[model samples]
Target: MTAITLGHLRDALHAGCASAVARVLDAYEVEVDFVDADADELPGMLDNGEIDLLVSAWLPRDAGFVQHGMRLIGLLYRPVYVWASTKPLGPIDTLTSEQVGRFITVSQDAPRLKAALATLPNLAGTPVETCDEEVLYERVSAAAEAGEALVAMIAQPHALFHTDMLHVLEDAQERLGGEMEARMMVRETVAACADSDMLDELSEMTLGNKVMSALDYTIQVEGVDPEDAAEAWQRGRLVPR
Candidate 1:
């Protein structure tokens, strides 16, 4: 048990993880540090000990953090990059990779999408692969019109359309267990806390709490789950989201 500081992106994912930590470590009087790092810089903060752990939100896309002081505690959600297309894919259950594959661009969302696409026995093709997120969206937008080459992009805006022109070929999140996961970033500094015993006690207190929605938490050792306790804390304590 160590001081669990979180360097986060200020998203639901980050909030969710923080609350879970709070629930487990309340009695130890463990401090919850919130390091406000830009979404892109979160990994850096962990490496720098700016935060104790990144228990809230998505894991990194790159392997740069290998063997760092950080250790993954658990996953909260499956990250997703769904394909919403310009045309309606009728009876989607029968989709083939060739018919809809090209429309589903690949990037970091590949792992989740791959599992979802498996259900569509007929969906297969050379899905346009982009080197980065920006280009992936660009390609999807360009194909907005029929014979228009673009299929769909990673951004939510790509899914928004004036009419039925764009339809979700598949919900990446739904298909991927809400398409999100959480990992804790146990800082080297936090691990060396003078009060390590306090941390361990707190960790035991907050085990198996499902505090994943509405971004809130409450710490209680009075026989309540951590997530629900967190919800209470959010409602009664934390500032507005």
Candidate 2:
């Protein structure tokens, strides 16, 4: 078993993939070190050759990390930014200024911030009460766990990884438009490791991490026809493949 120290923000699909991989290849000794892995931090780690691989797996969140000298494995997870509420939802699309009990909180990512604002009603100007990607997930998770006013913003692919804690109030895929993509990066140092048996297992284990799909979900709502995706929305669920 090889040792790899993965650097990614918590609540990312990478963490979820690690959990899945644990079942198959515990001998691989996968250990996840949760760092902020901010835009600046990722490049620094790769520059200094500090980490084995940077497996956030969501391309759009930090494209600067993709500058030359790194290679990417196939798309591992969908880059998602989504939110959910614990209690019953109000008519969000029609939410008036008076109904703006809460505002959409988001990460500093330009695409995520823009997508969240464009989806609902009553939002004007820029994002309010900002947090990074991981914090946004935690806050949204807390809101759903404690049954608070469920309002948040996250990458759509990353959001799918946390199906237990959150649901889609709105999908950024539709909002972000066609150009948005889902992918992950492995530093040049780890590129050699990518083709080994370890990476083959890693790829199989991480195949559909919700963070890299074009539009994939896995909530497993009983009796909700997979074919009738729109009907799933009426029941507060979405198409789960």
Candidate 3:
């Protein structure tokens, strides 16, 4: 039996996809191992043939991995970023560029923030403080409590976890007219060595719609385990190749 190695960022979104992919491979009687990897390390690992596949979030066009000789097989989801505040953010349209620029915080290399800045060129020079994901919510919430008119641009699913303390800017994506997507990638060598038919079936099942639905159900629905949700989705929606 061939042992296939898979890697993904350690997050709820990627975890769901990893689960679904694992189940799909199981049907083909393939041995699979899962690795939780940091985003920065994925490119290097893939380049060195450390993993057969990497399930990663969609990146900007000029992202390093795009030129790293990896093949993007399919999209996992189209994720948006929200400008969340601890206090109410008034009508997005009415807010002046300067008013919206009090301060904006984001994670390192966040595609949503990149898009937002591109849309609001006036905010290009606005203060952008970077923070690790674990403390991102706390930093934004603290800024709000300090009476600072600030917003944190964060991934949509992560915003849900901070809903108790933050009010998501309702039309942030509408204003930006762009959203980041998640995609599954594999090295060229891995792609050539693997089963193309199975890959195609997995890719078809890995569309943004199916993965996002699975994510929402696992993350928002009551009492559902992520692994179980992914397994159920695979059994119900996927046609074996």
Candidate 4:
């Protein structure tokens, strides 16, 4: 292949991992191009040969895509999901639906989160509003500023950034599921790359909590460009010194 095309969601964690991938490939003298894509769009792009690799979280429901010839190369992170609020909500185990105002979540994650909420005793009957991530955050921030107790389901990394603006519902795992494994997915046509000895060198790579926090701090909080953040992460964290 002239170059390996990698696709990922436009999120901080993947942004860091994309950097890591680029640096690894660079060491191998292979060119790489990173493409930002929606979670739903990744399957189509992989199947249609528009991209070779994808770095994103895959829900259990997404196993069908694997049966359709997609391959899981390796996991990059296992992010804990949490329920964040603007006001004190007490323990997650003791919280009830009445305490939650509007449940804001990302549009891409509505289906999964909605299903989880349906089964959660603490969140039963709580209304859910799915919107673009930026809009979701804005709405949550506004609701909190107004003294409305709002809860949002968010990944641990992104939630950490909002600590000053939101209160994380500790022990949310009591009501939610386990950590989501963010991983690299490749088209079967390129599955051989996953098995190549060259893959081993990069396979051990992972975007841990600390690495993600730094990326978010630099890229989102400090306003660094995603590409530059990736480069710094690749060299400073991923590459052996």
In order, the Cα lDDT scores of the candidates are 0.49, 0.48, 0.64, 0.69
lDDT of 2 by residue, 34-83 (tens): 34455566677766766655554455546776656666655554444444
Candidate numbers sorted by TM-score from highest down: 4, 3, 2, 1
Clash totals for all candidate models: 30, 15, 1, 0
Task: For residue 215, give model 2's deviation from the true position in Å.
Answer: 20
lDDT of 3: 0.64
Error of 3 at 59 (Å): 3.4
Candidates arranged by lDDT, highest first:
4, 3, 1, 2
Model 4: per-residue Cα lDDT over 1-241, one tens digit each: 4478877777765676677677777777777888887667766776777877776545553453453666676777667767788887786667787888778878877876777676667667778888876455567768878999888877666624534777877774545666666666667776665446547755667777666766765665566877787787666752233
Which portions of model 4 show Cα errors greater than 4 Å? 11-13, 57-61, 67-69, 119-127, 142-148, 159-164, 170-175, 188-197, 220-222, 235-241
> Which TM-score value belongs to model 2?
0.57
Error of 3 at 231 (Å): 2.7
lDDT of 3 at 173: 44
Instruction: Tell me the lDDT of model 2 at 25.
Output: 34
Most TM-score-accurate candidate: 4
Candidate 1 local lDDT, 174-214, one digit each (tens): 54343333445455555676376654543443222223322
Top lDDT prediction, candidate number: 4
For model 2, the superposed segments whose C-alpha errors exceed 4 Å read: 1-5, 10-36, 86-92, 106-121, 125-128, 131-150, 156-167, 170-173, 176-184, 188-190, 193-195, 207-241
